[model samples]
Target: MTIRRTVKRVIDGDTFEVARKIQGTNRIRIAGLNAPDSNQKGYSEAKNRLRRLISSKQVTIVPVGRSYNRLVA
Candidate 1:
């Protein structure tokens, strides 16, 4: 299913939060990509790239699976 929502926040490089109708505010991760953590090198670059890609944007989240509490999209 495709859910329409606004990007709420970027947690890191690979994870973000979205505000949706059915799920309210939830976290989602881009599958199959591992971006660096906060303490790692290239972390800023990765996060900045992701921010420039999706910040303040409306996105279509197609949920393929779930990992614990976060949805994988």
Candidate 2:
């Protein structure tokens, strides 16, 4: 099973950085819901929604590989 982590920051609707005291930085990108760029339409809203959805909460995280820092929710 994947380890659950507390959200540290919301990078976007599809991604957020997880805070941990490991040797390196860790970030997670949502599996689905490819949000547009910050300048794209509904970008802010989508990002906001994502933030609100997971802010200050714990979630499960399963790392796929080092090739990509993205993690599917």
Which candidate number maximizes lDDT? Answer: 1
6: Cα error in model 2, Å: 0.4
Query: Model 2, 1-73: lDDT tens per residue?
Result: 5887788889876888776767444678766458988889988998899899998898788765442655555
Model 1 spans > 4 angstroms off: 22-24
Provide the TM-score for each candidate, comma-separated: 0.88, 0.78
Candidate 2, lDDT over the whole model: 0.76
**lDDT scores in order:** 0.91, 0.76
**Per-residue alpha-carbon lDDT of model 1 for 7-42, expressed as tens digits?**
988888999999867776889999898999999999
Error of 1 at 20 (Å): 2.7
User: After superposition, which runs of candidate 2 have C-alpha atoms over 4 Å from their true positions?
Assistant: 21-25, 66-73
